[model samples]
Every structure is written in structure tokens, then in C-alpha cells.
Target: MSNFDIRDLLDHAAAAEPAQPAPASADEKEPRLSPLAERMAALPVRPTYSPVIITGAARLADIAVVLATGYAALAIYIAPNHGYPLSYLGLLPVFALATVAALQAAGLYHIGAMRSVLTQAFRVLASWSVIFLLALAALFFTKTSEEYSRVWLLGWYVSGLAGLFLVRLALGLAVTRLTRAGRLDRRTVIVGGGEAAERLIEALAAQRDTGVRICGFFDDRSDDRSPNVLAGYPKLGTVDDLVTFARRTQVDLIIFTLPITAEARILQMLRKLWVLPTDIRLAAHMSQLRLRPRAYSYIGSVPVLDVFDKPIADWDLVLKWLFDKLVGTILLVLLSPLLLLTALAVKLDSPGPVLFRQKRYGFNNELIEVFKFRSMYVDQSDATAARLVTKGDPRVTRVGRIIRKTSLDELPQLFNVVLKGNLSLVGPRPHALHAKAENRLYDKVVDGYFARHKVKPGITGWAQINGWRGETDTEEKIQRRVEHDLFYIENWSVLFDLVILLKTPLALLKSENAY
Candidate 1:
């Protein structure tokens, strides 16, 4: 029988009591009645994982193995007959890329495929064989086959294949161990409860190897309409409670079990949830309507329609973090003299600390202390920025004015990027916790204002480079900044970051809105 059929029976038999009594208010210590659940059901839900870095590490390991295997084979052959030309080494990178590409195309990198050692070993062998044939063909077409040692070429092919197989086998074993311990599993939650949600839960349960643990379910309906327990899963609370739960628990994926035909309902739900930094999918397995083949992604055999994807996910997050550290560190060293001079200037010009630490909204709406070179007089400084900095403000010191206008005061935040791992070199600019525009909180001015915190705040951002930097005195200024920040998050790439970095200096030269 199917997994759902089995669960259906088990859940029905075990439905004697509610999973855990509905959460009670602080005044009442004991578990409360369904009234609490009903109250939460009326409230709005918010839309919201950690980036899966394991896959990125695996990819890097495979690439290293490929390179090492090629070089090892070449060395083995060269040791017998003096040395070969350095030109042969140039092919190592090309070979590595080709093998990885081939493996990816073969779906060997898919989580399901990586679960089995035998399956992965076969895929690795096939990918390496394809790379070898392509390399041989290229040599033949160029009529340069005889230039290199035939023994080395053949030996490298065999050694590379063996190396790839061994690597996959080891990884497969490690992943199995991690999965059993729940360390490698993705923490997922289901939205909507009832038959559709139960079906999705059952489908997920069948694929034990997929490593997705369904935490619970969230539905807008009261417990009477939507049972407190469905298919062995508890109804955590209503959609509103889901937002708080997701934030507190670090939820990775939020899967909506509602059908696609409920477009208005789905859209409304999305409006609430999109502000979160999590993968949101609409379960499409139970839908009678068919979509384009490319439109659906599978969680095991069950299909899900992609709604919104977390920005800079998985391997992309890894690459961005590495880029931030490497580039941020280099910039720190190169600008050390200027940093020291600025410190001295700030110290001499103002009778206060050189650095200013202000609490700003960071990734996932958490607060982080952001560092900056202090530019205002100690007595007159506005740590919370309750009052906006205006043109020729009396609070500014002599050196502070120069640094603030020239954007040199932001240099200390580079250390934030390199050290804290909270800031990226390129992302939305972090706003002070109580930062205001036009005498109003930013969240009041713009809907989904917190969405910008989905990614780590940056030292420099797309908005800043596009002339949205400096004082956000007007509501429109903050709104425009949020719009730009959203755009950058939606279309992030390593190349895009470099482009923004390149244009920042020119943008800072204008100082259009700086006081």
C-alpha cells in the first residue's frame, strides 16, 4: 500500500486527543481551550532556512578530487620519463569543469541520487568517461594526439574515474550517517491543513531518504474545521502563529498545500508570507490542472509549484560569503593607512570614540551592531538617529563632515563584513533599528519593509550605488531604497556584486544627498 494509505489509518486510530494542548496566554499556566486557536486563526500569517552549504562543500570536494586525480596521473607518468611540458597542466581546470558539468547534467548532484553509493559511483564513472571521450576527440580534431604521452592520458582517465567514485562513495556514506542523526535534514513546515496537507505529509514521509522533516502544519481555519491533528502531524497554530514560529525555529521551507485553482487565496497567503527568507512552494501533486513540464519541481515523486525562492540560496550563499571575506580583507589592508588617518582625524576633531556602534536590523530581522567611524560631536551624537541629519547640522565635527560627505566614514563596516559574517560586501544597506523617514517608521511607510533583511545587510548596496545613499530624509527616499534593495535581492550574482562595487566610487563622487 502507498504511504498515505498507511498513515491515513494510523492517524484515524490515534486521533483520540489533540497533539499538544493549544498554547495558553501568560496569565494561564495550563494548556488552554480551542478559543486560543480560534483567536490566532483570525490573525494574519507572515511569510518567511538556512542556506544548504553541504551541497556547495560537496561540489568543491568533487572538483578538488578531479583536479588532484588528473595531476596525480600526470605525475605518475612523468616520474618514469623526466618531466612533461607545463602546457599539459592547463587542461586540468578544463577537465574538472567538464566533469562537473557532465555530472550535473546527469542529475548526479540531485539529493536523491547522492543518497546511494552504488548509484553515485556509476554516475561518476559515466560522467568521467564522457569527459575523457570529449577530450580525446578534441585532441584528434586538432591533430595533436601524439604530442602527449598516451600512457598518461589513459592512466589519467582511469585514475580520475576511480577518484570520482571513491569520493562519491565516501560522501554517500557520510550523508547517510548525518541523515540518520537528523543533522542533514531540512527543517520544513506545511501550510494549510486537511486532506491536501495530509497527502503532502504522506508523500514526504514515503521518501525517508529526502531528508525533509515536516515540523507541523499551520491553517487559518479553527480546530473544529481543521483538525488539531492530521495524518500524525499537529496543527501548530494558525497562519499568524506560523510567522512567529518560523522566525523562532529557523524554518527552512514553507510548503503550502492549497491547490492552484485557489488563486486569490494563494495570492493573499503569499502577500503575508513573502516577507520571510524561506523557500515557499505550492503543492501541485493533488491538482487536476496540468502545468508546463518545466513549471513543476519535485520533492521526491510529488510535484510542487514554485512560488517564491529564498535569495542567494545554497551554493550561491557560499560563494557570496567567500567573495565578501576575500575582497573585504584585501580592501582592509589596502586602505589601512587611510583608516588610521581617519581614526586620528576623528579622535583629534571630536572628543569621543573613533567608532560608532549602532544597532541595525540584520538578516532575518535580527539586530546586529554595525560599526562606523564616528562623525558627529560626542555630546550631540544621535545614536538612534531619532532626529535626521540635515545639511550643515551643528552636531557634525570638522573631520566628521569630511568623512560623512566623502563616504569615508563607512570604511569601518568593511571589518564588519570580514569579521562578523553578518554583513555582505554587497546587499541592502542596514537601517538603524529606530531609523525614521519623514517622522515615521520605515515599516509604516513601505509594505514588506522587513523583506530587505532577508539577506545580510551590506557595507555598500545596489541602492547606495544608484544614488540612494546618504540621508533618507523623505518617505520617498526610503521607499526608493527598499525598491532597489528588493531588485538586488531578486537578481543577485557574483558578477552583479562586482559591477556594483566598481560603480560605488563614481556614485560616491556625486554626494547628491550627503549633508
Candidate 2:
């Protein structure tokens, strides 16, 4: 495994908030910063969480498709030429369908299956063999045996099995590389302190292939309850800090080292953190009570039971991301002329840059610069986004008005899709960094707000096309938008992404959400 360290980030954090150096005494006056110094001081903030779930999911799907197709194709090719038995070709499709059904039914396509490629390969082989045998039995019973050649059938079956094994052998290494690069990983946070958290960290470190990167930890008590460092990982903050961290850090799993006996406390903590988009698991190491073997998931030998799970994980995410980049790139290339014209128009109609980059909250509540065409006058632009663009706001330039209304101002964000790799072509729309609904942070208002970050924010999202875009000045608007975003996250796919993309042009024409 390649060495990875987050020390630079930590050092930057420490320097940014330079410790006051425990005062000579609580009585001595503290050094004061000048107004400029105060203004320049910035708090430690983690980058907005980036979505890996989709990427991981897509990769898994690709692997499954490759193995299934390769196996079926090999089987058809090697089936000893059954005397021009074109009827054997019919069996190919049947075998392929059966293989897919069996694979899905056996759960061999799941993200968790990546943990044990050998075990999973065996399951796939078993399932595929069963399906193939069933198909052969059906053919025989139907008196279709004359349509096949025994030699061809034997060759096909043998080759097909070989192909399955080969695909898995190749995939095992690829998946390991992806997971190690932090591409296919579960963001985890330690929930207990001292020895428990330390042991957990050491174990996770020992098995980097487990794909569980510690985002940090949250302990209720301060120095007394937790140590300054647990297995070289600091206490990022408190449980409250964990909530904020979950919002700001790219986290997916939260492992609670506290036993099941702390049921009341665990439940209370879950009530607070469970609302975020993360898998909450109770680390079952210290528990005297044992659950059924099937009831728990293990990292090496340490067992954990599920509490909450971030939805649309692994291969699902990978497929969605692939679709976004591929389709988004094609669209951008095709529409470059239109994008250029829009930029020229913005420049001629307004005394500002053609593109307006706004700080928006991205995955994990980290700030990202989202691109748009300048719609408002240079001086009147709202940096904090406290004021919503109105129907007749004088600050909006002539070009801004047209682009904003027609949704052309968003055209520049395609580069954002290609460049920063922040937004996708389809998914949930990312809101402003401080977007408020009902005078509360959107995260505070919406349960599992960060969950939406499980996938990339899109240029045109499921919510926007469904009439949930534009100025969210009212609580209902934000609530409805969140609802749609959540819905998209829960039921995501490449086909779904394609559907959203195809429908977006028509949705843009409607302009119900556009100001």
C-alpha cells in the first residue's frame, strides 16, 4: 500500500489557529491581534466531502459486466461447433441472462463482496454453474438436445468457467488499487476514545485494504474523556464537532467503540449523528453479548453491526460518475460555440468577468467554487448570497437577465464538471455555502443533509428539472428541493442520469424555477 498522510492538513490547521501558548498564568494579558490580523485569521475548515460512492459503484458494475459477458461469450465461442447449430447461439443469451440473475441474487455484485475476491468468485462460479445446468436441463426436457453438440457444449462450459475465474483474478488487483487510492473507500470516524479508539486505529491501519480511512474521532468528554491523541489520530473535536465534522468532512462510516450496554447513551448519540449521511456501526469488540454471525460485518476479525448506512454506495456511484463525465464532456464540446457566445454576451452586457464563481457548499459541507455567468452588476454581486436574485432586480445586467432566466448562465459550469471535478452533469444541485431554509443551516434543517454528498452535485439535477431549482427563499422550496435531492441519491443509476439529462432541455424551457 502507498503511504498516505494527512499531517500537512493538520499542521495547516494548527498554524491557522496558532495556539496562544497556555498563558504564563490565567492572569497575564493575552497578546492581541491587529484588526487586519483578525480579519485575515481563518478557522480550520475541511474541504467539502467528495463523492466516492458513485465511482466505487460504477467500477463494481463494470467488473460484473466484464466477467459476465466474458464468461458467456467464451462459452458460446468454445462450444464445440455443434454442426452449425445456430440454435446454440440462442443458449448464449439465455446463459448470459441467467448469469446476471444469479450474480445479482447471490449478492456477488455488492460493494462488500469486494472484500474477498476468492470467496466471491466461488459464489459467482457456483451460481453460474447452477444457472447453466438449469438451462441445459430445460433444453433437454424440451427435446432440444438435438440442437446442441456434446463436445461444443463441454468446451463452452469449460471455457466459460475459465473466463469467470480469469476475470475475477484481474479484477482483484484492480479493485485493490482503486480502494487503496482512496477511490473506493468508506469514510470512517472513531466514536470512542483512549484504548478502544487506539486499537481500532491500529487495526484499520494494519488492513489498509479494508478501505476504511479514519476521518477522525468524536468523544463526549474532553481531555478527561478522551486523549489528545489516539493511535496518532487526534480528537478532531466533540460529538458536536463530529456533527460539524460530518457536515464538513468527507465521512461515510462512524464506528462506535462503546458497547451495546451503553444502549441509552448510544441511542442518544445516534439520534444526533444518524441524521447525517453516514453508516453508523457499533464496534462489537468489547461486547460480552454476541449476535448471529450473519448479523455482523467484519474488518479482519473485529465485528460491527449496522446502525445507519449511506445509500447508493460502491458500483452505483461509479456508473453515475462515468455517465456524468462522458456525457458532460460530449455536451460541452458540442455546445462550446453556444458557451462562447454566452460569454461574449455577458462581457458586452455587463462590466464584469464573463464567469461568476460563487462559493457553494459541496459534499461534506466543504466550500467549492461553482461557476456561472455574471448576472448581476460587478459591485452589486452578493458574496454571501444573503440576497436572492429577484425578478426585476436592477443589479442584474441585461445579459445576466437573459442567461439567468434561460439557464444559460450555468453553461460555464460544464468546465467545472471537467476541471475541478466537483459537479456532475446530473445529480443533486449544490447549494450556497451558507444556504438557509427557515433561518437554519440546510444541514440543521434536513436530516441526512450530508448524505446527498454521497454523489457529486450536478449542473442540472433531478430536483432542478423536477421544478425544485432557483431561489429557495421559502422553507417549502428548500424542503422540496432536499426531498428531491434525497430521492435522486436513493434511486440513482446511469440510465436514470441519462433520463435526467434528456429531460433537462425540456425542463429548462419550462423555467418554473428560474428567476
Candidate 3:
């Protein structure tokens, strides 16, 4: 296993150059993963939540508290005044949003804010008071104070403060509980070894509440140069193996301890590691190239340069997930009749099940069973998709031919998005493991093909909408598809997803390439 050569990623990048992976370990007969490596890959990991999710939750809770308190004050105080201006109702959401903005500016939204209950309380109180003061000053300057009730304002402010305290207390307890359960910690691994790695480790250790838990090291150098163990963490494997480990375990962060001056090695490492969907950072504590303060982001007290971050992560992931579930359910319900008709067509046209399940690569190289309306004969079904359906292919049934062209065959992938949650409604299309273009595997025919896997695959995608869908029989066809996929990933947004989805039906009308 140690003697086997690693895959030369550079060759693939150099122009879709043909290459083969190193031979498998003799006993295990595994090409990429060995027996021990497979076991290590399956090592249990504690749950890790995004720090943004925690802070965002705090902001939402704070906003809710303020809004609810203001409304309650309005209901209680309005009777005494016989009736205050109806315009005051419009001020509620604005005030709540402003309060959250103030808290965020005061750093109350930081993940570490709840680490100390007293400190959090003080910060929240100070920021909330300041926002109220500002609001009062604004009302006075605008000469609108006469229209509003001082008594109502006082009640609102005081009650809002009390509500904030309660919410913060609950938030603090939740953070404390997560901390105790070790669910808040990010499982991290250092990408280099030796003195640089030690310095980075020590710097991280000096800081509190960083939530960074070092797992091990990975360096390509021999044991003499980069020791097998450094600073109490074992050298897990080489950078080549780090990719596999990250894919299997879903590691959160990969910090490179190599000096910034090692540009060549850093670039090389990135060429290989960029395929994994993890935050890749460079430790800059020892670097002399100083940038502006805003250019650097800190994890605890350790400043680092962010090279690459997990895409559609944190809040964006939350939004996308919510979009998928809510919109997916509505679409599924609305399209139920169409889906049933398609199922019946397949059932009557062939003596096979209505849904065809096939394993395809998903996020981070995980295999997922994608459901589609069975389009081909049962005896002639291509589960591995070794041979892609071609125009007028003999294997396709009468029902399959029409559905495949119209994309009705793919409607069942909504089950994948809504139920399985492994796929997005709009992203790169997933392909079979052995899917080929020009008789070569896609990875061999397109440079940086796996980089598309950085995000979850979709039923419909930027490529599909832009005329890259359907058969990928030639290298040019697959290459163009991958290029569009990468472009969508780089410029992903909710709006972009919606635009692609809107164009999907139109794209299906022009099925020149589809089998």
C-alpha cells in the first residue's frame, strides 16, 4: 500500500490527459482505499453545527423578542390613550431589525458571545440601551415624539429588555449544552508538519472557545522531515490520502501550517485538495506579508488567510434546504397527477417497476440512489449507465423515448430532493460512477471534474438549462457540461437557481442532444 503511487492530479489538469490510478493494495485489492484506511475513514465523529447558524439563531430570537414585546406594549397601552396613531404599527418591524443590527455590531452575534453569561448580558444590555437611546434621539430630531406616547415607548423598551434577557439566557444555556456535548467543536486537521505545524498548534491552543479540535497531521514528506507525530497529533497520512479521509468523514477545516513563502508546495497542495468541500486556510502568524485588518479573519486569536471555503455553506445552506423542502413539497403535490400518469405509462409499456433506482455520485463523492421513472426494458436496463442512452436507442421503451426527451422521466428525482435530501433542485447533474465520454471516464476526459462534486448534485442545473443536458457521448459534450457546472458553482445564488429552474422546461423543448 505504501509503495503504490498516488494519482497525479496535475496530469488530469494539464489537458484531460489520460491516466490511471495506482494499483490496489495486494491483500485488500482496493484501488484507492485500503483496509486500514477504510476503517479510519469510518471513524465516528461528533455532530458539528455551523457557527453562523448559532449566531443567526440568536439574532432571530432577539428580533422576535423585540417585535413581540413592542406589540404587547401596543395592546396594553393603546386602551388608556383611547387610540394611538395606526402608523405606530409600522415602526415595530423596523425597530426590531434595528435592535438586531445594533446587537450584531456590538458583537453579540459572535459565536463566543454566550461563552460567558455575565459578559453576554452586559453586552446585550449596553447595545439594546444604546439602540433605544438612538431611536429616541431620532424621534426627537424628526419632531415625531409628540405623535407617540412616552408611556408606551417606555413600556416597550423596558419589556423588550426583559424579553432579550430571557432569550439570551436560553441561548446561553443552549450554547453551554452544545459545548459540553462536544458538538460545537469543529474537527480540524493540519495539512503540514514539523516546526510550522507545532507553532500553529501552540497558537491555536493558547486561545479559548475557538471550537477547533485538532485531529492529526498530513504531509507528503518522509518521517525524517515531517515526523509521524508532532505536537501530540499523529501524522494521519499524506495529502493524497487527506482527500479520501475528508470525503468520508466530512472534516470541517483543513489548515495548512506551511510558511506562506512555500508558494510552490502550497499551490500544489491546493490543486489536489481543492476538490474537497472544506474550509482551507493558511496560518499567517509567522508570515511577514501583512495585509489590512479586514483582509484577515481570525479563529480564536489565530489569524489566517482563507484560501477556499465550503460553498453554499452556513446560512446559505439553511436557506437552500428550506427552499428545497417547502418548494419541493408544493411542486410534488401540484405535479402528482403528471407523476402518476408517467408511472402508469412506464408500468403499461414495460413489465418492470415504475421507478428505476440507480446509484450516482453525490456531495463529497457519496453514492446516492436516484429515483427516476424506468425508461428502458427490464432485461436491457443499464443500472451502471455504462452505455448512455442515445437518440433512437433500442433499449429505450416507447414510453421511455418520449419521457426521456421531454424530461418527464426525471420528475421522480423530486423524491431525492425532498425525501432523501442528498440532492438540490438546481445544481450540477450527478452521473453514474462508470459514465463515460468518448470511451473514457469523465474524470479522464475533463479537467477538475470532481470539483463539481464540491456541491450537491441536482436534478436540473445551470448546465441542463443552458443546453448542456442529455447525452455526453463525446469529450467535447462532457467538457462543456463540466464547464457550465463549475460556472454555476462559482456564482451560485438563490436567484441564479430560480433562473435556471425557470429555463429548464424551455431547455427540454430543445432536446437535440438528449437520447
Between candidates 1 and 2, the one scoring higher on TM-score is: 1
Candidate 1 has what TM-score?
A: 0.82
Rank all candidate structures by their lDDT, best first, as comma-separated numbers: 3, 1, 2
Predicted candidate 3 versus true structure: per-residue lDDT over 474-514, tens digit per residue: 99989999999989998999889889888888999999888
| Per-residue alpha-carbon lDDT of candidate 1 for residues 242-345, written as tens digits (9 for 90 to 100) | 66565544667899998788899888888878888998988998999988878899777788888888888877877898899999999999999999999999
lDDT of 2 at 457: 81
Off by over 4 Å in 3: 1-23, 26-39, 79-81, 84-87, 133-146
State how far residue 407 of model 3 sits from its true place (Å): 1.3
Badly placed stretches (over 4 Å) of model 1 are: 1-67, 78-108, 118-154
lDDT winner between 2 and 3, please give it. 3
- Tell me the spans in candidate 2 whose CA falls farther than 4 Å from its real position: 1-84, 93-147, 150-187, 194-217, 223-236, 243-252, 261-264, 271-277, 285-295, 329-341, 418-420, 434-454, 462-468, 474-476, 491-514
User: How does candidate 1 score on lDDT?
Assistant: 0.79
The Cα error of candidate 1 at residue 454, in Å, is 1.6
- Cα error of candidate 3 at position 149, Å: 2.8
